[model samples]
Target: MISKNFYYQLITRVLGIVVTAIVMAFFFLKEYNALGIVVAIALIIQTSLLIQFTNNTNRKIAHFFNSIKNEDFTLRFPENLDIKSLRELNSSLNMLNSMIQKVYLKNEAQEKYYQEIIKQANIGILTLNKKGHILFVNPMMENLLNYKPLNHINQLAQVSEELHRFFSNIEPFENKLFQFSNEREKVQLSIKSTSVMLNKEELLLVVAQDIHKELDKNETDSWIRLIKVLTHEIMNTITPITSISASISKFFKVGDSIKPINELTENQIKSTSKGLDVIKEQGENLMDFVQSYRTFLSVPNPDKEPISALKLLDNVRLLLESSNTNITIKTIVKPFDLEIFADEKLINQVLINLIKNAFQALENRDTGGVITLLAGINENHTKYIQVIDNGSGISEEVMSEIFIPFFTTKNKGSGIGLSLSKHIMRLHGGSIIVVSNDIETKFTLLF
Candidate 1:
């Protein structure tokens, strides 16, 4: 196939030959015709210029096609070609280049979007090939495992010996959850695996989540349910016995029926009356104790508000002060104003109970034995109030039961004060922990 430039060169050569043939004929037929010779020479010079122009244009066109072949679209072809045929070719090539560029840009954008979603996902996502080779892991997976995905994907093993055993036991396993613990941290993860077909090959997609908080909440709820069941049973037995005994005592008042029968019956009635009175009193005490339990569980969903530590301590001190001036209650509040979000009423109850216990624990100690109340914050960013006693400290055995319902060391104690106070703290999303030795026992309320 001859190019447009070749056709132009052929046409120029043909014109020059024809003009030369005419000049030669004129020279032979009519000698010394200078004008005809000059015209022939001019046509030869004009053809030479046309040939050079065609050669240059062809070179540029070759370079343009070579650039496109090399995927270099930066080379721009001439749009305004003097030759109509080549001009149409240039327009078609430019349109094709523009279409290819648009497709490349769209593919690049989609690749970037896919990677961005993987990076931003909250669920810990991981991919494992059929050969158990980890192919991909996101940032969430790295964060949950406390190991960077960039470092340990294909090389590191995700399952431990225990988890491996559990997974191997399932036959033709579909999706399954396996609990795993890390050797590096106090973290537990539930890994759920689902096999997916990608590129006509099987791969596993593992989704992991940390369930430590959920487990802790479940255990706490179980304990509360057990305690409620026991309290209900105890109340049921106590209530009926007290009521029956008290009604039986009214039989004694119907006397004078039989003389001898009346005396024996009256004596029996007196004993029953005394027994019934004891039962009734104990039942009422039991009811009050149960009421306290209800109150502990019924910690009004705290209307949490930021409160100053100093003000909270002052309120506790005012509530604890009595007419007797022997006991010295010292408040060692931090100078800086520490604020915490908590229920003021519930916190005040916890502080006051600890204060009263501290004072009571110091009953036999020397006068002015200080019951120190300290308020501060811990490193975990949780605020705390500590009540320290300088009198007779609580024994280890008693400390264990200090927060138990109806367990008290005092002579006339209901034993629900500390228990109720601890529950109140828990309801406010906090806790009360007691640590005691023979020297000093401290009750720290953490909020």
Candidate 2:
């Protein structure tokens, strides 16, 4: 309808101009010089009016667009114009501008909301361009660094030179730990970086968290667990020694004084000898336990080399099978050539430990126990080996203590296997994790 109205107005104006020119020509041809001059003047006025009318709409549209480009929504075109086409055009533009303004306001509000969230976040967040220009740094980040108004990565030198170097050389999609001392306290930051594209510009989005408290808590928890296990193991050995020593002492002592040798019975002497032997055995066991603990604490750095995952799994399967084959053993290596750069010996120890645990978990099952030795790359493109078992799975209560040294449910278990495995993985810059249910258990060694 608006188009029709606009075309009608345009056609009418053109017809008027054509008719005025024709009339002016006729007057001139008839030799009516004064009338011809008057008609020619009127024709010029009509043509000027038509040009102005078209330019008016064009100017309004251009101005509206310019206002939008500059993010200014204050420009309002008059809707009470004499022409219907002009009035309708003005109203439609006003409506469109109003809608766009509302959307702009909404988006602005949302951006502000997100910015507020970032500002109040507990963890530190910062974005840097390739030139190290800090695009955005939240208040939490400033607080964490103990330096405000952080405008560039180089400004990290104001906090610590080492921190500046860390930021400068940080790699994307990797986690790094940085420790530095400020005036207030020692800060242990767990930092991670990733690439983010904003407005067609690539930025390094780095998130840093003050993990000092968490690390302290974890250290304290680990100490407590170690103490508990140590106390339990030591007391087990010590209590027996104490009891046997007490019993043997009674054979020779009378009211805290040594009895005469002639008064000692043969059975008493034999009992004393047996008690001494028992004490010696317990002392040896205690020494071995301490030695194991020492070994756990002294895990050497990995001698890394590329080792085929399939070969590793197969070797472990063969080693475990040579002793017992009651449980069905299976090997799975994805892509047939997946490999890991790690100490082959240390990795073998970890795999053996996990596979043994799987064997133990399935030992009680009568007929259908299955242990799967799975080797592959995980979703993160990290190499991993899984020892999965279809058996009575590990209970949650036992699972929590499985990684603690000398904490075990088995009667004869020294409880060093899983903990040692975890330590070896840690040395290799890897990790071990376990998941279990009533029907199955899986231990994954990630590198």
Candidate 3:
């Protein structure tokens, strides 16, 4: 509410100016004398000065609001106004401007703080609109991709189509595992997507961390475990034979007394024969274990070549045709021309091993038993050859150890098949994963 004095002052000034101007005009027209004209000029001058003086506070207030709008908050409010209401308005505006300035400074500081964190993070970060236009990209993103000035998600298509597909189909909270191949090497990236809304614009925020080193660490750990397992098994197989040989030697020496070379009893001969047989069996088992280890480590560097997926699938089908297993085998090649760059022989070996495993699973089934080799690109446009079996699937208990070397469930299983396959894929800068349930099982080789 305006103060009574403030309202009356405005009314009084306007009425005074109008009345004096009207009287000056009347005197000028009624008497054209020198005194009358002089009086009229004096009144006019007084009115102009009064108008300017009365509006002096309003002009200053307008300039104050203009300064606040422009964020130029250095304008000082008048402190010496004779009018009490004008002084109060000026004081309130000054205080309000000061508070707004503090709030603006605080907000600016917060934005800078977050920006610094995002810039220094090790993971690549991206904020994009619904059209895939990059709204903001952190420095880590440029480092990870080695693509400077990234403006749109479609730019990834020039680097890798798989990467393009990945971002386009990414959903909130989705975790995606993919590899980006550069000229020098391939980097394994694990990305997670989150949805955020800023200023009413929907955006997808993605965080990608390079996991190549992590994978190497995990692989090194697996190798260590395998070595330990090998050591344990070797000691276990040899320990029994060592004890038996020592006991047999005691029998030959007649209970610690040196006997003649030919003075052995009939029971001693039998015992010796039994012990020899056990020793030979254990020796052969150890030999077999060593041979398996040799085979496991004998994987030659893949002779890299552009191998047609269809041709590889046909070769596998022919190889499996020689087996008498009644389980049906089918081949599916999406786009028919789908191909991969890998060692043809190694990939064939992996595929054949997977098909053999499927056949074993289908052994007792009479109907609805089939193994399908599906070759296609995943949604991320990465090449994949998946072996799916509709027979009794792998149990969860057994699934976990399927890829561990020398761990097997089948009677004649050597247990290194899956492990070898995994190593081969890793050599090709890819991986293999097994997904199984009660109804179906899948082994996917991703490249």
Candidate 4:
């Protein structure tokens, strides 16, 4: 309607000018000089009015766009005007401006909401561009690092030079542990990074947490578990020896007085010899258990080298296949050329232990027992080897204690294989994890 009215107004002005020009020509031809002069002046005034009218509308539109470009939604055109078309145009511009303002305000509020969440988060949050200029640093980050108003990655040096270097050289999707001393106390931070694109520019979003307390808690928990296992094993070995020794002592005594050797029967003598032998056996077993514990604590550093993942899996498969003909073993190495930088000997030991566990898990299966050795690069581009078995999976009650030394569900065996595997992976600066369900169990060695 506004457009139609504007066009109509424009046509009327043009037609009026044309008609006035025709009248002036008629008057001039008739030699009516005064009327011709009056019509000529009237034509000039009409032409000026038409140009001014169009220019006014164009200028108003230009002003509205300029205000929008400047993000100044307050520029509202006056809606009251003599011309209906101009009035409607002004009302439309005002409505558009109001709508835009609402949208802008809504966006601002949402941005603030997210910013507040980041600010209040427990973990440290930071973003930096490739140039090392810090884009954002949440309050938690400031509190964690004991630095405020961080403007650049270089500013991290104020907290710790090592931390600064770690951030500067950090790669995407990399995780690292860093320790530093602040005014308050020593802190250990577990930091991770990922690449993010914002506003068409690449940035590194770093998340960090003060894991000092968590690490301490884990260490304490590990000690408790170790103590529990050690105590249980020691008590198991010592209890029988103690009971046997007491019984043998009673055999040699009469009413708390030593019995003469001549007064003792042949039966007592035989019993004494048997009890001594049993005590010696238990003592030897206890010594072996302690030695194993020592070995678990003293896992040697890995002799790192590139080992073909395919060959590693195949070697393990061959070693275990001969012992178990009823079970099927499968090896899968993605990209066949994929390799891991680790000690072949140590890694082989870990794999063998895991495979043995898998074998045991599948032992009860009557048919279709399968143990799969899968090696490849994971989503984070980290090298990984997985031992998977289709069997009755580890129960939830046993899962948590699986990695603790001397904790085993099996009736026979010292139960240190999984624990030793975990130690080896940790020594190699990697980790071992397990996931199990009713159908399958997967143990992953990540490097």
Candidate that would win on lDDT: 4
lDDT of 2 by residue, 1-447 (tens): 677888999999999999999999999999999999999999999999999988987898899999999999998888898889988988999999999999999999999999999999999999999999998999989988999899998888988999889999988898988899988899999999999989899999999999998888998998899899889899999999999998998888899799999999999989998999999999999988888889888888898998898898888888887666678889999979888899998888888888777777777777787889888876878878889999788888888889998888887768899999998988888899999998888898888
lDDT of 4 by residue, 1-447 (tens): 889999999999999999999999999999998999999999999999999999998998899899988999889778789989999989998998999899999999999999999999999999999999999999999888888999998988988898789888998999988888877899889999999999899999999999988888999998899789889889999999999999999987889799998988899899999999999999999998888888888888899999899999999899989888879999999979998999999999999999888888888877799999999987899989999999889988889889999988887778799999999999899999999998899999999
Worst 10 residues of 4 by lDDT: 406-415
TM-score of 2: 0.80
lDDT of 1 by residue, 17-132 (tens): 67676776777568666866776676677667766656766776787778766778776657797765556657766776787777867987998899789879876787766555
Clashes of each: 0, 0, 0, 0
List TM-score per model, in order. 0.47, 0.80, 0.55, 0.79
Q: Model 3: clashing residue pairs?
A: none
Superposed Cα deviation of residue 344, candidate 4 (Å):
3.0
Q: Which candidate would rank higher by lDDT, 3 or 4?
A: 4
For candidate 3, write residues 1-447 as lDDT tens digits.
335656776777778767766776777687755656776676677777667756776787688778877888777777577777677767777788889889978988999999999999989999888888999999988777767788998988877788788877788888978888865679889998899999888889989988997889988987887776677678878998999999888876766688786887889889889999999998998888778878888999888888888989988988895684567778999989988999998998899889988888888887667888899998998999999998778877777667889877776756789888998999899999988887889999999
Error of 4 at 206 (Å): 4.8
**lDDT head-to-head 1 vs 2, winner:** 2
* Pairs of residues clashing in candidate 1: none
For each candidate in the order shown, give its overall lDDT on alpha carbons. Answer: 0.71, 0.89, 0.83, 0.92
Model 2 pairs whose backbones collide:
none
Model 3 misplaced stretches (Cα beyond 4 Å): 1-224
Once fitted onto the true fold, the runs of candidate 4 whose alpha carbons sit more than 4 angstroms away are 1-5, 18-33, 59-84, 87-91, 127-135, 149-180, 187-207, 211-214, 243-256, 259-281, 298-300, 304-307, 337-341, 378-381
Clashes of 4: 0
